[model samples]
Target: MTVICEECGKVYHVDPDKLDRYKGKNVRVRCGECGHVTQMSRLMDAAEEPAYDFEKAAAPSMPSAAPPQREMPEEPAPRPDIAYRTAGTEGRAGWLGLRGKMVILFLVIPILLLAISGYLSQQLLRQMATDITDESTELVLQEGKEKLMQKARDVAKQCEVYLQNHPTLEREDFFYDPEFSMLAVQVVGESGYTCLIQQPEPERGQNWTIWAHPNPNIIGIDDIDMIRKALGPHFEDFFKVLGASEGMRESDGNYMWKDPDGKIREKYMAVAPINLEGLPFLLMSTAYIDEFTAKTEYLKEYANNKTAEIRNINVGVLLIVIIIIGLCILIYGYRLTRSIQYLTEAADRISVGDLEAEIDIKSKDEIGNLADAISRMQDSLRFSIERLRRRR
Candidate 1:
């Protein structure tokens, strides 16, 4: 499109694409020839007028002896160069520059990923701790049950030998005789004891009777109902083990036992039948199962504390990593953006014919290479201008 200086009638050729943004609006432009500001209308596709021929209009009026007049220097033509630019007249809000974008890419995204990894690691650690505790508890219980069964068998053998030596000792008189009662009642473990009980025989009017026991009140009596009342729902397990004693088979089981303080605790019991003829007595040993797994409980608590400590350390490490990354990006991004700003200002100055603009950026990275290239271009422009000045 053509724009004519209304003051000097000088014609200027303007790219139609440059006026696209001002479509349907009035715009003003300063003429390069006469500096005359002209208001252009939105109807940009007007017919091109014939260019005013200044040379032809002046030549006919000049004499052959007249000297030529020097013309004023023309302003440099505008070039559409796409480059990193700052805000013009129209600045956008919340615009993230290169540094801000870099922080999001290098710092924020990595921190999120680290947080996710840390969460998953803690969950996995908790699951592994739970599994190890369960397996260790089971292993200790198995070993304890075997030891308890062996202890019951050994005590049963001792009772059979003692009863064989005193063949005339009756079940009713066993608790009264101190020597026989001592042999029948033995200590099994810490807070546990072994006792003798007779198998049930309904035809002879006999029931589950305690012939010898650590407690004198329960000796030489039918204590089955009292035990059942104390055990409540847990009596079935104890009864099953006792019933198997009549078949001459060793029986071992676990059951809940209520203590004097109203605390319900799990207990392990083992029963071993006596081999003596005409003797329907069996030796039973019982103790709390917690006594065997006490060490395992301590170890589990220790593991939980250590796991919590390790998790704290992991959280600290993650925070430290994020801080380090943030600091690095801030330091490096600031330096990098400052160097680019220096190059931008230098380039802007050089574009306006200021060939003396200094570009002092020096580093070992790509930005340094760019600074060197721009410095060479500046030197070249200076050389070209000096050469042109000398020729003139």
Candidate 2:
């Protein structure tokens, strides 16, 4: 017979045949684990009807008991249906009931945040790179423009030195003298050249003469209106500097032209008044803006490539980080759930009144504290049982 304690729900298996002294009477059995006493009736396994009818078998006049014969029932007796169940376990919700909720809150949410943060960082990188390049390009363009102006100043200084060496040279010598003429035709750089043009003398009915220039066809031409037209729409700016006092210089507005390749491009020019010993000369310097910006196109291309590469690398790294994070979450969640499983088993044991069962978990977390509480309860119950037995 299986007995379950009503006080602590402890289960005990006792053989009914061994309870010979308490046959058919109520007896108390103390549970070994919690010491709970339960009343149970001892039972003897006796058949309901005899296998043979004894009254019919015994005959008063039989000289000798003829060989005894036994009568059997037509059918076997029905077996009793007995089932054993632990007390207080019907309320258990089962394992894995709470782990699913924990997984969503602790694992899923953080992974989404990680991916979002990574994408945002990747997006901002391109803008950051653009800002850096823009700042550096501004400085380079300013330096290039400054260098052009300095070149103009150096040319003016060279002409001053040339005039000092030729003390007796007259004003007209600048046009025909080979040495002075070559100085004006020197190329500053590609798309840049030096030139000397004289001011218009309206009194003598003489027009502006290009005294020295890279273009031999225009050297002695007195075509004033035609020359201004060839200087393009922004020629007034050059005229402003030319008419200024000696040593004065100024920049003209940007000049637009189509090169031999037919691509529209821009350049800028500056003019300074040159008085070499009273010989009036206009020193004009011209250079294309394309020279300064030529490398900028390539730099812009490289920046684009760099941005693409960085984004790709960022995505790859994000994927790797996510994988690593997911693995860690799984490992930690498993361990946490395992601890919970221990608490569950210990609780089941206590519910069945098995107070002596060891809760071997030694952790200091919540589950361990719960086991300690159960141990305390077991001790209290055991002590109460001892006191009651002593009083009895």
Candidate 3:
């Protein structure tokens, strides 16, 4: 015979022959519906007698005709301990749900903050690069321009000495002498300037070329009027700035000036009160602004390109960091959400009456601890429900 436990709903098999051994005693039969062992009197009650036998006993006074058999009602199937188990499995509304929410919130908020931080960091880096580039460009240009000015000064000094040594030739002949022209020729050659020097009294000018080859190119002139016309009034200021004296004195060093058209020029003009042969003369060397400014343009371009490259690299690094952080957050959120989903489903099952449902989580972190606590609570509730059912 199969019997169900009253306390734990465990089924047990018993032999019918054990009924005699159990007679006259309070037999402890384990309930199939629960694990509890219920005590009952060994004697069978009259209620358990067959209906035919009871009818026979009741009709004894009459002639013993066979009594009609009445149909017996079917015994109802034993109800399982659904209520107890359901009550046991019901989850307590405590910090577990809140904890899961906190986990999800923590993951999401940090990701958002990281994105904002990365954007701001990139902006700051770009600004710093730009500032550094600007400073570098300024310094390079300043140094280059200074060096070019110094070279012009040296060239002017050499030309002044040459004019002092040759003092016997006539003003016209001195200006025209190929040997004396050498100093002016060398000045323009070394100074990186396209130069033309004019001697008004000789009615002539010399154009000096210097930028390649063994020696400087020189041209002599005899047209004084043409030279004067080309010199213009600007030459007067140029000569004044150079401090040219009317006698045998040295000319001034190179002086820079901006013309009305905004072009910068360096000029060194000297005059001999008397020429090498005691004749009057003038010598001038001028270089245009393009010579110095050309070098600075390259520096500016380099600074701009370097700044752009640095900014791009910083931006790329920022993007990579952001992407990595975002992906990590997404993964964390996915796991957290999945855990919460499991907890929710477990809670739902408990609400409807399945106390044996277990909450298992893969993580070893706080969420895992929460799941463990929930499982333990379910087990405790089951124990309590079983105790109450047994007492009743």
Candidate 4:
């Protein structure tokens, strides 16, 4: 049997008995000349190369009439130019050679850049959230501190007013004064502190009984004695400032002073001297450092908890956004890669002369446009080949 390629005009000889293999298949035999694979039916015709019966044709009447032997034709030498052209032609075949590579690169680079941009954006959001959380917590703590300071000043002011109004009363008599004594008691109750109102003996500078209210169980009169001992040397200075002040002196309020027993302590004290008829008296209100320290510690704990909650909420939001962005990137990449794969497969088919292979990519994107363009090129080439064949 003889086979001739419709595409490149290459011919092959095959046994007629082997024809069954080519039936009902889309198989094409490769043409060596153009490197195109033409359909088996298009390449072969069994009737063109009939089987010969050599024995019947060569029968006996030939003994004395045998023909003279003729010179054999030499085999043609290989043409280097043809070989080079065939190799060059084969190399130019295939879609992904250069154009396809460029298309793949165009799709892949953007996917990579989008992923990187998403990661960077997530980082920036996290940093901004952290900074805002820190600043907000600090502001809360500052406000709490300011409120505590203001409360301390109010208590000090009330104590000074009581003494100035009760003139001439002895330290003991001053405590017995119902109006002033009750006022002092009320101030201590509201201040959230264990306070003592003392009127020390004139010779002792002031001797008074201490009152305890709402103590945190660890602090007491003993703590007060320790505080008084710590403020011993600063006692004169405290009285001098107290006597000179009307509204609680700001400088006096923050100063560290010593009491009679010489121990170091911070005291918020306000004193007012009174002379009632012929007696002299001074009313003094004192608060220990631990009173304000406890409130500050509570504020610190509250601030810490609030900051943690904010951080947790911020992290949750960030993670959700990151997950959404990741999913988008994954979906985008999959679609882009799938379109390129389709183009690659179509190119491979077209390379082997299957110009009927078409890409079904329907996207309106650049890759889709490229696929459409290639399909058009294939149709145009097929049309040209058909026109050339009709002319022949």
Best by lDDT: 1
Q: What is the Cα-based TM-score of model 1?
A: 0.75
What's the TM-score of each model vs. the native? 0.75, 0.54, 0.49, 0.48
Please report how far candidate 2 places residue 229 from its true position, in Å.
8.8
lDDT of each: 0.77, 0.63, 0.51, 0.51
Model 1 lDDT, full chain set: 0.77
List the candidate 2 regions with Cα displacement exceeding 4 Å.
1-132, 160-178, 198-211, 215-249, 276-280, 293-318, 345-366, 371-392
lDDT per residue (tens digit) for residues 1-392 in model 2: 55554445444456566666443354556665565545555553443223233334332445455765454323322221222123335545546455665566766777678678867876787777777777667676676777766666677667767778887766556657788877656676677887776666667666567777777777767755664666566456545544552344454445564455756567766665665644556677777876776677567668879999988887787678767866776787677767776666666555544555576778788777877887787788668766864553
Per-residue accuracy of model 4 over 1-392 as CA lDDT, tens digit each: 44444555444554545545444444455656665556544344435432223222323355657684343343332221111112234444475444444445654565566557656665665566556555655565454445544544554456556556654544444335666555544443233331333343357454343432333242223343544455666655555554454332232343465534745666455444332233333334445554545555565566556656665675676567656755665677677767776786677667556777767988998998999888998898789878966764
Evaluation by TM-score, superior candidate among 1 and 2: 1
**Cα-based RMSD of the predictions, in order?**
9.1, 12.2, 13.6, 10.2
Tell me the spans in candidate 4 whose CA falls farther than 4 Å from its real position. Answer: 1-10, 13-37, 41-173, 176-186, 189-251, 254-267, 272-282, 287-317, 323-325, 362-368, 390-392
125: Cα error in model 3, Å = 6.8
Candidate 1 lDDT, 220-283, residue by residue in tens: 6788899899988988987877777776667888888889898889899899988887667788
Candidate no. 4 TM-score: 0.48
lDDT of 3 at 174: 39
Count of backbone clashes for each model? 0, 0, 25, 23
Per-residue alpha-carbon lDDT of model 3 for 78-197, expressed as tens digits? 532222222224546456454455545764466567657766775676677666656765675455445544544454455446667644544344335666555444433344431324
lDDT of 3: 0.51
